[model samples]
Target: MCGGPSAVVQVVHVTSLRINNYGYLERMVPASPSTWMATFTRVVAQAAAGFRRSRRLFHPWGECFAGTITLLVPGTLGIREEYPCLVRLSKGLGFVGAVPDALGLAIRIERPQPWDVLMVSSAGTGVLGRLIITPSALWTRPCYSTLMPYQRADGELMWLHARALGGHTVSVRRNALTEAIKGAPLGFELLSGASNGAVHWVGELTLERTAEPGLSFDPGVNQVEYLRLYPGWLTAIRSSAYLGSRQSRGATLSD
Candidate 1:
């Protein structure tokens, strides 16, 4: 009886307004799990039909190449070792030939440690700018980023960056990126730091694309040594989306 009948009427009115607001939102954004799944299926079929539609929600290019990643400097746990790896180059969206789409590079390291690094092309540095830059700035010479932050040896937060060596361009197929990395060995370096901070080289990665296929790559599969995945809402959404995609593709997460 905080406010008696008058209070109850006010509460009812407030509830009605909230319900109406939700109804409006529902009309504006008809988002649902089933809707998302349907979209995924459609994209897959489109890509299969050679329509240039990407199966992945983001970074859908399916062409993967194998390589080796070597720690040039001591990384987390002071370990300097070489790990067999696979790198997948893709477009963020399922856009048709030569159309603008975010570019991506996903790396999976096996043996000695099993972890995945997903990088997206960006122009500016820092947390906010990283998300703002589109795929237009991507090429073989420019750097790609993981977007998520990692913890450094000294406990400082850092972002990961990868760049092609010898001034080579990692352009898209029909453009030049595919040809550039097709034959001869391509070299890349992994660096750590903030968008505007001092950059530190963590390792060197080489791609050959001649290795046989073995294991699948997923960032949510295993834990990386010192690299920390970004925390909170966005990370949670990303993890769920990744798991869903893997499951749909019949990929398993190892223990």
Candidate 2:
């Protein structure tokens, strides 16, 4: 279950990395590369090649929309001001029948240096819930989490989440998401928290599919200095995978 933001706990600048009840940040020592890493790399490379040949590496066929994000209550990261953004919604694997497919919400904040926020559907908003990947058949049902923690300049880890609000509903099948959003606009209440503890209302995201555009979002590259991905090794692997996917497709880094 999700709770409101704490009033007493003073979450200052994200760079300061100080939360009232949260524990101190600890360094994650990297393990020596083993067969595990090699095998994973090989498999990912092969998969990226196949995806590149067919369509894309990650969310292959997605519907893009023009939207805006309003930061109502900037928390630790202190991301203030509203932003004009482009939002993309897609199913991870294109699972058929009753199988639940992981839903993705990719947002490109159109600032001088754009911020790409890629959120995946999560099991819940609690500690354990944020870690577990919860695939959903409905586009508006599940809560999308950043998955990997965003490290603060002061060494604190934070997370961003979005859950559909105001009863905007849609069942995601092969070709359903686009039509649903066309009839009724999709809206989500943005939430931020320490790791996955308790999330507070930070802002709102509203999306509309007026016109479509081909674009790619990279969380590793297009990042602001204030907010960075934590656990260097993990982000390194993610960046490699994204690179392979992009290269095989004969596509350069897109804004």
Candidate 3:
């Protein structure tokens, strides 16, 4: 966690993913499903109205909300092959939108950070009035790995890019090496690691926001009015409950 004295960390990722449209299975498909999964999930979550009120709770303006992270992945990665887990998690935590697909993936974290100095500065000078600013960071670093182009019995190249960030890497190949050595276990670990990195970056940004003052709170402004107005403006930041739903879930793991 990164903040002044108190902060909460949340992590999320995909556990199991599957591409339903593909008739036959390919070797390189599983290694980096989360990337594709992330992309699909966001679209689904938005349609479901997830992540509605994430910005206001975690910055210097609000009550300093912390300690929550959420991840989205495919259902094939779960220990129980449970389909409802994703939806249950998303709706319950307000994270919603964990979809599975074949293109690319994404992971997003919501934490309170300071409004951009320029935004606040403009507000102070009356150029911009009553704005809701969401200062959060997103990381979508991709990883790459080599694979031998091989034809399946159907004569098609099963190749995928194995990229990783944070502390995990997915090794995709056009062979059985992935399933033979690690199988489902290692895939779960990799997803978790990526989620951790996403959450860590959010925490870092929240802490950075506290050190910077808004335009109204700048040194030249009256300290008393600046302090008095800060909380009121924060009230406009809005608040939403982080709950689990049918398409998403909280990323907290139990030992």
Candidate 4:
């Protein structure tokens, strides 16, 4: 599944291969069109042989790997138009899955579970974060029956929190939350638990529909307020201070 304005999703997959260098001799023997065609045939044969051997030995999840690569390089496929270059690349690389339906566009890799990657994207936007789910989870839980959509203060669709991060509180439009429930048949329940030692979801929320802008809340307030605009920018400064303090203590112990 993908998200966004339905205009940015694209996915592509390529296989990995290895080749031996037969440098001077091979180069000197391949100057004509027929020779080049023969060289291409040989390369394909070798790649196929390698793929067979590797599949038997490691059996690396090619689908997962291709999906990961698609997230990293969405525009590599022509989600908007035909991308012959990507098509050729996939063929040459020996991909063994369905041809990418969309042109390569911007995609994000959503991390849902430890070992699984779920692909989500808006209609046209490339894939979003990879949401990985275990096979057992798939069997036990309903998939895509319900989705959570987050909205910005201006009532615009923002990020969707498919899974909760340990220390992050997602701020979303109240109406959007209700809409998500109504749009999907899955039963909805508010999250109530401790995250990062802080109590979350302490009260019932009433959903309202209006044009008014929502309030944005900042959960973390470090002393360096001047650098608030740049989130995580002062991490290095904090780390340095912490290390220096430890060093001073170590010197004192030595003395």
- The prediction achieving the highest TM-score against the true structure is 2
Which scores higher on lDDT, 1 or 2?
2
| Candidate of highest lDDT | 2
TM agreement with the true structure for every prediction: 0.67, 0.74, 0.14, 0.15
The better-scoring model by lDDT among 2 and 4 is 2
- Looking at model 2, report the run of 10 residues with the lowest lDDT sum: 14-23
Cα displacement (Å) at residue 132, model 3 = 21
Writing each residue's lDDT as its tens digit, candidate 4 over 1-255 gives 265455755432111212346422222332343333334444544444454633211111111011121111222343321111000000112223432221111111222211111112122111232122211111112111101222223333322212212232211222322343344321211221111222222111111221122111111221112112122434333333333332322222111
The global Cα lDDT (0 to 1) of model 4 is 0.22
lDDT of 1: 0.61
Candidate models: Cα lDDT each: 0.61, 0.72, 0.21, 0.22
For residue 75, give model 4's deviation from the true position in Å: 29
lDDT of 4 at 191: 24
Ranking by lDDT: 2, 1, 4, 3
Off by over 4 Å in 4: 1-49, 52-133, 136-255
